[model samples]
Structure formats: C-alpha cells, structure tokens
Target: GPGCVLGLFTNRFFVLRGYDMKTYDRLNRILILLVILSFVMAIPAFAQTPSSDPDEKAYEEAKQDAMGICPPIFLRDENGNTINPVSRVNADVPYSPKQTCGKCHDYDKITQGYHFNQGKGEKMTKNFAQTYPWCTSPGQYGGRW
Candidate 1:
C-alpha cells in the first residue's frame, strides 16, 4: 500500500512494520549501516572489460567504425562519451613531433610535403596546419648547423 513505509536496505526493501520505537530505531540504524557498507564496498566501475560488457563492446565497435585509420586505445567516461582519445597504439612522438620526427622525415618532406608546398611561403594552409599530425608554425623554427 502507498501508506506502507518500506526501506531499501541490503539491496532489498523491507517493511518496517510492527516494530516498537527501540526496534524501529535499531532497524533504521541497521539500514543506514548497510547502505554505508554497500557504498564503502563498492568499487569504481571501469566500464568492465570491452569483452565482458555489451555496451563497451558496442562502443569499441562503433569506435572502430568511426575511426577508419589505426584506432587508438581511448577511454569511455561515466557519461558514456569517449574522452582523452589518443592517436594509434604505437609511439605518438612521430605524430606529435617535438624536435624529432623530422630526423627521418627531413626538411624536404616538411617543406615540400602537403604542409608547406602550396607556395604560401610564410603563410600556412589553415586546414593542413590544423589536421597535419604534428604542427609547426613558420618563424617558430630555430634550427641551425
């Protein structure tokens, strides 16, 4: 009945009926304790494994579909939105070039490749600069022999 007060404790709701003040107080305390215990015992859910969980599996498949190139291992947040998505699984240095990546690629590739070969000289292609893996603005170079 709607008038019946049921308490959800220990993962189940029990009707607190026919109990005196002392008994009701004891039950209330027990209920509070059980809730606290359950909360304390709870572990931080990590979306389980991509195999064991159906949702994660679906997300993994969706990600694989969304990403045509090599897929990087990223994490799904609590809201089920993907966050901190990285690029590929191997070394990111080649893609995120700091001082290297040019060691093997060289100036010819950098200057003549899709990034700088448009005859813009100092001006860069906005699209290329934004999409190109590693971005280096001109006049930002200080390399010398």
Candidate 2:
C-alpha cells in the first residue's frame, strides 16, 4: 500500500509493519549486520591486484603490442607471401582498394568509412564540424574541400 512506511539504514530499505518498535529496531540491526558481512566477504576480491587477472594482463600486453611499444610480428599470407601493405598496382595494371587489401582483409567497408572518405564529397555533420572544426578547415593536414 502507498501508506506503508519504509525504514532505511546503512544504504538498505526495509518495510516496517504494524508500528512495532521492537521488531523494526531488530530488523534494522539485522540489515546493518548483513551489509557489513557482505562487505567483509568481498574484502579479498577488492584486495586482488590487477595483475592477478590473466585476461587483464593479456589485454594490456596486446594494447602495448598494437601501440608499437612492444615488437610486432611480421604477418604472411596463406601462400607464404610476406604481407606488404605498400604494394600497389603499377601503371597499366588496373587496381582498386578492394582488389588490393581485400586479398587479406575487407577493404570495401573500410573505403566507405569517414577517414577514407576524406577527399570525397561527403558533407561533415554540423556537430562534427563544431566538435572538430580543424578537420574541415582548409590549412589543416586532414582538412576537407
């Protein structure tokens, strides 16, 4: 019922029925003790260091490797061809972005992305321009026409 009175103590809420002062006081103390016991049980979990988690350690190592802080592995194609991103089709050899990078990864979706659409006629949103006007400014390195 909307008329029920709620008793709050130590971040917990409990309903008080029948205006029994003794029962309410007893329930309040029980709830407080339960909260304290829960916190005590969680102490060992909180004390555990970040290095104790193998997943976290692995993620940190991967991040370092990706950021070039750690050595990078040379990737090769299925046919033992050294994967070189710089290789491009020469004159009279017709090549597209999809034809190039698509051999190893999906380049079609990447080409349609915002970063690759730099010189394209895609209009920058007003919010984007307001947030990062340098991207649209003429003198900046990433400036669009």
Candidate 3:
C-alpha cells in the first residue's frame, strides 16, 4: 500500500519513475538554459565600476582626505614641558607619550578601550581564577600569559 502511494505521487509529479527518456532530456536542457540565463543577467551587476556610484566616490574621497603623513611634533614630558634632546635639564628624563599625544588626542578615552585596558577592571570568573591562580582579572593583565 505504501509503495503504491509513493508510485502515484512520483508519477503525478514526474519526480522519479514516470518520465520517458525524451521528457527527462528536455527538462534537463531547459534547466541548463535557465541557469545560463541567470548568469548572463548577473553579468552587468558584477561589471559595474566602484566609481560609477556617487556615494562610493564621495566615501573614497573622504577616506583619502582623512589619511596622510604626520607632521613633525614636539615631544613633551610628564609635566607638559617640551623635551629638547640636547638640553642638559631634560637629557636623562623620559618623554611621556600621554602628555605628547594627549595634546590633540583624548588619551584617557583611548586607553579605556579593551585592547589598551586589557581587563584591568574586569571581573574574574571562578573557573578562570582557579585555572590561573596568579591572575586577578579575566583578561591579559591579571589572567593567562
């Protein structure tokens, strides 16, 4: 009974055993023709140039405007004093990057990022604490090597 039902459904849909060799060959050719047509229709979309879009052109221009070589900068120490390499008073003092770059950039905000902070104030999980006894936090600073 099950096999008869399956045979009826297959014959009705021409899915398995109902089609003659000629019908199957024609259906295969039509499927191949449709696939080729779809690829042909997609050719123009793939061939479009990036500069053809006004939005993309504007984005490229803006990106180019933002990226450039840095100009010469005066290095400053922790106390905001300019460090002259040859100056006797500043000869042995190390230049502080925070004071120098912080003049134009937000040092605090930049350092607050995950990469710079390295889990300094993050919570320590019980499993992590048990695994790395020396680590005080879940990240690189106090956690795994």
The best candidate in terms of TM-score: 3
Deviating ranges (above 4 Å) for candidate 3: 1-67, 86-89, 119-145
Q: Write the per-residue lDDT of candidate 2 for residues 26-122, one digit (tens) a residue.
A: 7667777788899999999998777878999999988988778534443445343455556632333333434445665676777667666654655
Judge candidate 1 against the unseen true structure and give its global Cα lDDT, from 0 to 1. Answer: 0.48
Q: In model 1, which runs have C-alpha deviations exceeding 4 angstroms?
A: 1-18, 46-145
TM-score of each prediction: 0.22, 0.27, 0.34
What shift in Å separates residue 105 of candidate 3 from its native position after superposition?
Answer: 0.8
What CA root-mean-square deviation does each model show from the true structure? 17.6, 14.9, 16.8
Worst 10 residues of 1 by lDDT: 91-100
**1 or 2, greater by lDDT:** 2
The residue pairs in collision within model 3 are 135-142
Query: Who wins the lDDT comparison?
Result: 3
Better of 1 and 3 by lDDT: 3
Per-residue lDDT for 1-145 in model 3, tens only? 2222313222235545667656655665666677789999999999986787899899978777766544457788899888888666575777887998888889899877777669787888888779888777787643356
**Candidate 1 C-alpha lDDT tens digits along 30-132:** 7777778777677445434448789988998888887875444434333333344255334222223323333344745575555344433455468756765
Residue-level error in angstroms, candidate 3, position 24 = 66
Per-candidate count of clashing residue pairs (backbone under 3 Å): 0, 0, 1
Ranked by TM-score, top first? 3, 2, 1
lDDT of 3 at 75: 84
